[model samples]
Target: NMIEDSEEDTHERYEVEILSKENRRIPAEMVVESIECRGEPGKLVIIRDLTREKQAEKELKDTQTFFEKIIDAIAEPVMVIENDFRVKLLNNAARELLPGNSETPFLCYKISHGRDTPCEGKEHPCPLVEVRNSGKPEVVEHVHQTNGKERYVEIVASPFFDSDGNFVGIIESMRDITERKHAEEAIKKYAKELEEVNRLKDTFLDIMHHDLLNPLGTAMGYLDLLMDTEDQEIKSELEVVNRNISRAIDLIESATRLSKLQSKNSLELEDINLREIVDRCIENFSYEASKAGMKIENRITQPISVKANKIIEEVFSNLISNAIKYASEGTKVIIEAEEKENSLRIKVKDFGKGIKDSSKQEIFERFRRKEKRSIKGSGLGLAIASRIVELHSGKIWVEDNPEGGAVFVVEIPKK
Candidate 1:
């Protein structure tokens, strides 16, 4: 339709052509020409109103452009591969992703996997085959080598059908996940390093354990020589030295066993006399108790035999040390063992400020302490004791002493 110069100058509305029989005027194109109809000369006129058709064509073109823009806008590589594994379409990203072969319909295997033939299930999965077989979407992850470097990609592929509802091809989208792959590898590396550090720590501990006791044994051997002297003053000093060395030995043994317990290593079990174990613990802790103005009272004189290991003795040693350390001056620390139906209960009670009601269970965890108790300790003593007891199928707990202190108890199976 063309506007006339006269129509533009008028203030009134311009002419609106009618379409078919409708009264409402719309845009139309009409052509009149001379023609011969049935041997008679007549002018034939044809008119076509193109407003709806033009709008529909514009809308369709805009929709097609929008979809094309969307496909090109994605950063991930995308392609449409037919059932024969030939690439039907590829986006700008995919074209740039694959370095060459822009003008050719390349095989998907050649572009992705650099293979001359299509992917077979024996070596690599073929998404086209799988999607056709299942008539559904499929996903796969692959590591490809390009430019002397490896890259991991996650491929999401879906089946595409023609307008006739027949399978035509598969739409495959690829996302680069090489960064995530590196992160997983880093985690595995760190785990291996941590394991190595733990092994070295264990080795260091073993060396320290052995090296420390060797010199202490030598010192004790020499002390025995001095212990045979007749002079009372020299003998008395040697006795003190012997007592301190013995306590040091007990501490080293405790440390060794505690470290081993952290690894959950198996302990050597043997028949042990509970009475002798208690007596030995009291003897080892006598110096510390005396320094705190406390005395240990052993109430278990009868021999009580049980199936336990050498580490079991450390349990009583730790409990006795705690009692003596926490109890007040001039207080008595009592130790007793009672035979039960299927177990033996060892009780160590101290007459001093008792443990808090809430801390009975918390005291057994690593590095936990009551805010009110100011005694200096590594805090692993009770934890180690609890672990050793558990290994022996035993239970260890603390209760409020009837005499204004705490009573620690350990119950172990007699077998």
Candidate 2:
């Protein structure tokens, strides 16, 4: 065939297979030229083996196919886009996202966005264009409309380079984040509703404080005058009434305080002496402790300054009062402090009934108290203490004392 083609065209080249000694087919390239050698008309032929070249070509194709299959197996849509906004290569997921009728050298913007030009804007910024311009990777969020349904997609565009380290284009991995976006929007809406609900609750509490507490105060004043009449039975009856009125007042005041503390986001902090605060709380509760046949052991005598506000005193006061109220008669309530690397750990331990493991966590929530009915409380005290400690970036928890009691621990930042 090469000799016949050389006779017509004077020169020809053919790629053909020839049989080897072992009868195996071998690929070869042959060149045939019509020539006059030694004054005779003949064809000059030259043959070159092509088995290695063919093998190399097949290996390259197989490598490309292997990587293409790996890319297609990925869940997220992947595309290799050229600098001209053309889709050079794509995976199966990308093919599903792109147009089915898209031809070779597909324009990415046209196939993906149904647009004639590249995407450009603050909201729908083009990550491909950014990568091309900056020669760096970029991540961007895009809202795509397909079949009249909006889809949120996060595109991670990375710079693609050839084997020679020359910049080629960008490889983009597109992840569908529509569900996550919807969830975030729902959370924001729920948060707004909760904020409004809290505002209404605060308003209602304020109204109750004004309308209920003022009249109760006036009634107490009348009772005080009535008790001065010097009638024994009447005086005892008024004393009971006075005690009930004071309890009602305390409940109302505690609720108001807890409400205010819950509504606050931050506090004005200062350098306060923890030892002084604890001592003052002990002094304030000393008479009550003595009346209950208990003594408060203050082990925090040394000057220890902590970053907190005046309200921190309320934490210690509540703990000590609670200890005296619950501890056995003649038992000592110990107030101790241990300085930490970045904070202080203060423990108010009482030789009383310890908190149950089941109710230990529940006790910190508002209106959730685990105590006997004889223990008169508004159930807002511990909740208020928890909120104040939270405001100071502190933590409070209860533990069982080694000597058969409860130990309330509070940790607060030193600085």
Candidate 3:
């Protein structure tokens, strides 16, 4: 306003909002200039209708804002890193994990780890490099120390490509797993403690068993001498004593044998007669069975040879004991064997109470027992037997007795 004529007419462009004849505001861009070539005196004015352009720009801005909000709404931290390992796009969750200071670079390593370069070496291996090389997704777990505290995070990374399908960069998703890591470590520690406790228990049993065997042997020896006196009363009393002493010894020995079988991974295999084992076990249990007024039927008369050890005898002993112990007054236990192409099958069936379907497999586990059963046992019989069968590369399972009781089966392969 103070320049008077101002040496000539000035040229300028202006953005202006104009009210159209329809009474609607429209955006416009105008250029004004004085057209003078020494004699011309008119001024030139040009106007551009920028309403459509402005509308388009506003719509694009809204769409970009909507997408950014959606990305930030996700719970897990997500980030997109360029080929040069610079952070390109990150959501709100990612921002919280990275440095917030203005001086920190946008590069992923620098923002998240305060490192000048990408992860390197075993201390901090970057999974993004693996994705770029393999063109496949990769997951890695890392212990991150930030803000004076350590936490574990698992990162899953995948290769990113441009719209044209050209390999460009990587996108990563990360989750904090510090609590889960702590839980796993606690489980491992408890397992170690349990294993040590079992070892100590077995050692104590061994020491006590060795000291008791000597006195038990002396009592049995004195009873055998008294039986030769030919006095009927003394002989009968001696018989009862000998039977009870033998039973105690068998019980002690069973505990030790069970412990030994559990600690071993394999059995010593040899040429063994399974039928002989059954016959001997039947004779061994004859006294108890007769006392309970029960008879055992040994249907396996034919000799079946298998690649097994003396532990095979213990297997049969346990089966027969279970049958006689669980069978009633007049019920008989039947020992049956079938020969197969790959193995031999033996069943010890009792007619009293068959195991519940739910407890059939569980009874073969250590210290597991059926509810409301009065029969006393250490509950380690079938576990030791199953282990032996497994060591011989065979299988053992029990089936419901169609008659009335459980049919205990054992199978071994011929060498």
Q: Candidate 3 local accuracy as lDDT?
A: 0.81
Q: Give the clashing pairs for model 1.
A: none
Of 2 and 3, the candidate ranking higher by lDDT: 2
- CA lDDT scores, all candidates in order: 0.81, 0.87, 0.81
Candidate 1 wrong stretches, greater than 4 Å:
1-59, 66-80, 86-124, 130-137, 144-150, 160-167, 202-226, 232-248, 265-320, 326-415
Q: Return model 3's CA RMSD, one decimal.
A: 5.9
What lDDT is reached at residue 86 by model 3? 74
lDDT tens per residue, model 2, 1-415:
5576557337778999999999999999999888877977888889999999999999999999999999999999998888778788888887776543456677887887788788999987888878878889899998777667888989999998889987788999999899999999999999999999988998889888998899999999999899998789999889888888887888899999998897799999999988999988999988988888898998877899888999999998988988887665528899899889999999999988788999999988888876755566777789999999999999999999988889999999987
Candidate 1: minimum summed lDDT over ten consecutive residues — where?
3-12
- How would the candidate models be sorted by TM-score, starting from the highest? 2, 3, 1
RMSD per candidate (Å) reads 9.9, 3.5, 5.9
Measured by TM-score, how close is model 2 to the native structure? 0.83
Best by lDDT: 2
Q: Which portions of model 2 miss their true places by more than 4 Å?
A: 1-12, 32-46, 99-103, 145-149, 161-168, 229-244, 264-269, 299-301, 328-332, 338-344, 372-376, 401-404
Pick by TM-score: 1 or 2, better one = 2
